[model samples]
Target: MRKLYVWDPLVRAFHWALVAGLILNMFVTNPGKTAHRWLGYGVLTLIALRLVWGLIGPKFARFRSFPPDPAAALDHAREIVTGRVHPHEGHSPLGALMVYNLLASCLIIGLTGWMLTTLTWFGVEWVEDLHKAFVTWVQLCAVLHIAAVIFESRRLRVNLPKSMVTGYKTLP
Candidate 1:
């Protein structure tokens, strides 16, 4: 096994912080409460920082390293079906798509959540509905992301979760 530095410190910190904020907002903090609102703002800030980091960060942290490519994702799906293990230094194609999905979902959730606090959008049924819908979507995507990470880690012999925590990948 060869160990390679993959995720940067900012990337790792963002990942865990986002996880905590999402969990606290979704399951712990009551909606529209101060804690929930602050957590939502924290998530939004993390996303904004990640966006800027994607532009100026290291190789594996850059958007260019894992651009959302549907075609490549499809091919990756085919590879999975065929049981071919092609380990990626960064995110796999399907993982890239999931990353984009989660990012957009979190952004929408944050925006709608913030909108709910404003005088204009407060008590607006549609905005509230959209916010709730995105929260559900993010929850589902988070599950899928976790399952895929575990599956890929087993199939590819890479400790993906550990890599995210340690900023290194032990790849075979």
Candidate 2:
């Protein structure tokens, strides 16, 4: 086994920050409250920062490190079903797809949320409904993300959650 440094500090910070902001907005803060709006802005800012980092960050932190490839994801799923282990040092193909999914979903949520505060879109039912839909999508994705992480961790014998927390993955 070898310990590889994968996630960067900024990446880890962004992940936790986004998690906190999402939890705050989804549960603790009311939609119309100032705190909720600011939290949403903070989450959006973190995502924007993450997008920039995905272009120029460290090796494993860059999006290029884990391109979204359907073929690769299929192979990964096949391996899982066939009881073959292929441990990835960075984000796996399926995980990369999830990352992109969450990023896009969050972006939509944030944009529609901001639109709600605009004069033209204020009190617009469609915009509000769209925002809520994205929020629900993200919430579902987050749960799936967590479950997949745990499942992959055991399957691959790598602590994925710990890698995100400690910036290192012990690969077998």
Candidate 3:
């Protein structure tokens, strides 16, 4: 196995912070409450920081390194079906799609949550429904992301979750 520095410190911090924020908002804080609203704002701030970091951060953290590409993701899926062992130093193609999806979902959820706090959109049923829907969507995506990470780690002989925590990947 070869150890490589992959995830940077900012990337790891952003990942874990987002995880905490999502968990707090989704399960601990009641929707429409002050705590929920504040957590949503915190998530929005994290997303904004991640967007800027994706522009100017390290090579693996950059948007150019893992641009969302459906075709590439599909190819990756094919590779998985065929049991190919191609290890990406950064986010894999499917992983990139998930990152994009989660970022967009969190942004929409934050916007809708903020809308609910404004006088104009307060008590608006559709806005509330949209926020709830996105919360569910994000939760589902989180499950999928975790499962994929575990599966890929075993399949590729790389400790993917460990890499996110330690900023190093032990790749086979």
* lDDT (C-alpha, whole model) for all candidates: 0.94, 0.93, 0.94
After superposition, the stretches of candidate 2 with alpha carbons farther than 4 Å from their true spots are none
The residue pairs in collision within model 3 are none
lDDT of 2 by residue, 13-101 (tens): 99999899999999999997899888889988999999999999999889889988999999989999999998988999999999999
In candidate 1, what are the lDDT values of residues 1-172, reduced to their tens digit? Answer: 7899999999999999999999999889999899999989999999999999999999999999999999999999998999998899898999999989999999999999999999999999999999999989999889999999999999998989999999999888
lDDT (10s digit) by residue, model 3, range 67-106: 9999999999998999999998889999999999999999
- TM-scores, all models, native as reference: 0.98, 0.98, 0.97
Sorted on TM-score, best first, the list reads: 2, 1, 3
Query: lDDT at 143 for candidate 3?
Result: 96
Model 1 ranges off by over 4 Å? none
Clashing pairs in 1: none
